[model samples]
Target: MSRPERWIRLRGKPRGPRAFRRDLAETAPGLGAGDLTALLAADGDEILGWGLYHPSSQVAWRELRRGPEPPDEEWVRAAARAAAERRRRSPEIDERLCRVVHAEGDDLPALVVDRYGDLLAVELFSTAALPLARLALPELHEALGTRHHRLALDAAAARAEGEAAWVETSPGCPELVQVEEDGIRFEIDLRRGHKTGFFLDQRENRARLRRQVAAVEEAEVLDVCCYSGGFALAAAAAGAAAVTAVDLDEEALAMARRNANLNRSRSIRFVQADAFGYLRTLAANGRSFDFVVLDPPKFVPSRRERERGLARYHDLNKLALPLVRPGGLLLTCSCSGLLSALEFQERVRQAARRAGRTARLERLTGAGPDHPVRLDFPEGAYLKALWLRIT
Candidate 1:
């Protein structure tokens, strides 16, 4: 489809590099979200960059380029190659399972590619990104040697970009496939599960949790919102004294149970309940753990839901802090890209104050090395984690 030429004018100074509708001085009358065009100044003298006009989104359009280096077909191909080459060069990341393309992190905004064993799960988050990503499937297969591809979109992203969320796989690729991460096996439900059926971004965090649990003698662990039991299983394998995994999704819990058995573990107590309520119950019952993981799903996917999401984070930490025995560690995480690491840390601190617990920050981390973030696109630096020591 031929893209229409529109005066993509900038109006206000955006806080970050991203441009929202409020920042836009003008938009094309009939431009599609994925349609590429040059950005302009209000006076129309400067061509700021290129963008994918996303009218349905809060972000009118994310910057595709800061210069006139067109994101043409060749640019897309090079991006695909560069993204793949970076992952292949990362000796620290397991090739068996890792993120190959991290949207804006790879300079290809709104498109993510995750490799699970033989399957490549491609998630397109914007109309602008969707076409470019689709056009590069052949290149991805050639570079990665993976013919099995599953392309999909989450509901929120789909709605924001005015695109239909779908699940389509290459011929002969099963909807459910088994993949290994750091020697632990997991079953990925690409068609039904959330965000490509696994949280690959938390790979390093899980490893760190395992190390923490194994460091202590007879360490008791609590994993809140333990979807598919990644942290719980890791802790169990580390020989924790006891591990309690809690989540609201029955299906995810069932999978977690199966994973535990696969790892020859009968010790993990898998509880199906709301994490918030469960944490409150555990605290009221005077239950405590030597280590705890609060890996909740994204409480806020967009800026509009930021208030409620921050509240949940604050309250969750408040309840969870009491469960950590003195000198124990609490690894709390937020996947909401909208929440800055500083803001998230403040939330935890506020929660600690409310709970009357002394919490000191020990380490601050984010997604594994596989999920690299671009320097310009700080938005790619979502997934903030705070490792705190409770006294």
Candidate 2:
């Protein structure tokens, strides 16, 4: 089949880097365009760079490789080599927890790469980056000189980008590796674990937990819904006498146990139970903690799920408030973009009231600096961290 074509025009703005768009004219042969609500480069064209276009997504296009000419096989090979070389240079991106390709950051639009020990995970969002990944990943393997690679797809980005359904995970490679976060070390298992094998985004939050725990001598700590034992590890490091982490996922609890061992400490306890169930149990047992960290996964996935998610959040906190000692701390976090900061705050307030407790806001925060939000895209501001003092 003959491919349709379109010229990509570059639009430069004063505030930031320029954007690439479809010009519709100066067409090229054997290049299919337009039928795709989004456009992904299929053939060669004498353009400024190798572009991957997605008209359907919030981000229309991303220029992967920059040049005044079309990207050839040699260009793809060199890109593969350079990406591997860049990954090799970073002490963080070794056989442990590290992000390899971060979409626009790595010059691959809508693509994410994670390194899990000897395993490599790749997530493709754009159609152009998808097929291109299928082609270039082999080259990436050759460049890395490794036979084992695990390509995991993040379907969330694909759905948001308006692409067709894609498979999720592939074969596994390794079991465990030592990972460091904010000077704290953790043991992570890539084969059966969470995103890229660990939640690296919570690095800053863990540091905050450590700081808070250190302020209270031998404070009893509760790390609720603690995935991989991040906050618990931080609390233990901060000199907390006893730290209890609760999560339903057995795999996560296993890794958390390993992470605790890596810290050369066994002062923390792990419980594989539902978050809300454990919270209610603690309340029933008349147990109170000096610090509680409520870091749950995305409860609100879409607009329709917002109301129910908010109710759930409130209910969870309502049960948790009584478990917090008076004048103690409660660190609550919501990564759901659908749950705005104001909405989350209101829910927490309602929870405190229901528990017959008075709470004061101590701090408010968001994701780390690496996950930058665009000026216009407020929805990009997903993670909301709230520190509260219950009295």
TM-score of each: 0.95, 0.71
Off by over 4 Å in 1: 1-4, 13-17
Q: Stretches of candidate 2 above 4 Å error?
A: 1-109, 114-121, 125-128, 131-149, 155-175
For model 2, how does the per-residue alpha-carbon lDDT over 1-391 read when each residue is reduced to its tens digit?
A: 2222544433332112223333332233333322121122334333444465555554444555554455555665566566667766755434244555555554545556665545566766555566556656777667665555655555666677565544444454555666577667877665577666777567678888898889998899999888888899889988999999999988888888877887886889899899888888888888999999999989897776888998889998898889889899999989896678999999999999989999999899876543445553345567898899999
Error of 2 at 222 (Å): 0.5
* CA lDDT, candidate 2, residue 365: 88
User: Which window of 10 residues has the lowest lDDT sum in candidate 2?
Assistant: 33-42
lDDT of 1 by residue, 234-259 (tens): 89889898999999998899889888
Candidate 2: pairs in clash: 38-55, 48-67, 95-117
Q: On a 0 to 100 scale, what is the lDDT of residue 80 in model 2?
A: 59
Count clashing residue pairs per candidate: 1, 3
lDDT of each: 0.83, 0.69
Worst 10 residues of 1 by lDDT: 1-10
Q: Model 2 RMSD to the real structure?
A: 6.7
